[model samples]
Target: MNTVGVRGYSLELRTRIVALVLGGASPGEAAKHFSVHVDTVKSYLKRHHQNTLHIVAKPTGRRRTVMALHEQQLLAQLETHQDATLQEHADMLETITGLKISYKTVDRVFRRYKITHKKNTGRQRTP
Candidate 1:
């Protein structure tokens, strides 16, 4: 049997799998319907049943700070002025918004936006 790519599976496929499992459809039947292996269907059912026991919500990956559009514009300005240090950026943001943000926070935002401290030249330098 060919291994199914999880990325290629859609929401509809997930719903179908859940419905088939809950409706007491055999693993083989469910697998045929989903175009996956019988073992895959059984595994999904087992996982679904296990998850239903505890029902605790899973924690999402790191959340980003919610910055306003104007704040983003200010960030752009800071990026253009590469000479400005992290402390300077933080101070400027605080002065404008009356919200004191740490230099680390400013640095993280810069990294997330791919705005490096040093601008890259088109020419590549050899070692």
Candidate 2:
């Protein structure tokens, strides 16, 4: 989100504006005190007094997938058993935890976590 052209006014400014308004000072008087436009003062006081202003910043970024502790343990198992095939790992995880993840998903998870796939070390036979 962009916060352009907004001056760094404190919450104290809003509090002072509210105090002035409550003390029978006109909106124009409050605006003159704060050096802001009358409409701006009105808007600020309206928001501050209404108790409906949301000052909290909303959460951003992608939500993480909620994995169980057992799922994490399964991932650790995969890290130790890199020689196992994707299908083998998937089947084993499913059997152990009843979570049915696909072989493609297992491969994707490995890649996503930067876990290298097992490299072939056996000698190749010539045709």
Query: In candidate 2, which residue ranges exceed 4 Å CA deviation?
Result: 1-71, 121-127
TM-score, cand. 2 vs. native: 0.39
Error of 2 at 27 (Å): 34
Model 1, position 37: C-alpha lDDT score: 78
| Root-mean-square deviation (CA) per prediction | 7.1, 9.9
What is residue 95's positional error in candidate 2, in angstroms? 0.7
Off by over 4 Å in 1: 1-11, 16-43, 47-63, 79-81, 119-127
Question: How much is 74 displaced in model 2, in angstroms?
Answer: 2.8
List the global CA lDDT of all models. 0.67, 0.68
Error of 2 at 25 (Å): 36
Clashing pairs in 2: none
Q: Count the backbone clashes (under 3 Å) in each candidate.
A: 0, 0
Across 1-127, the per-residue lDDT of candidate 2 in tens digits comes to 2232444345677678777887999999987887867776687678877873335334565543326554575587776875677788888887877778787867777776776565545633222
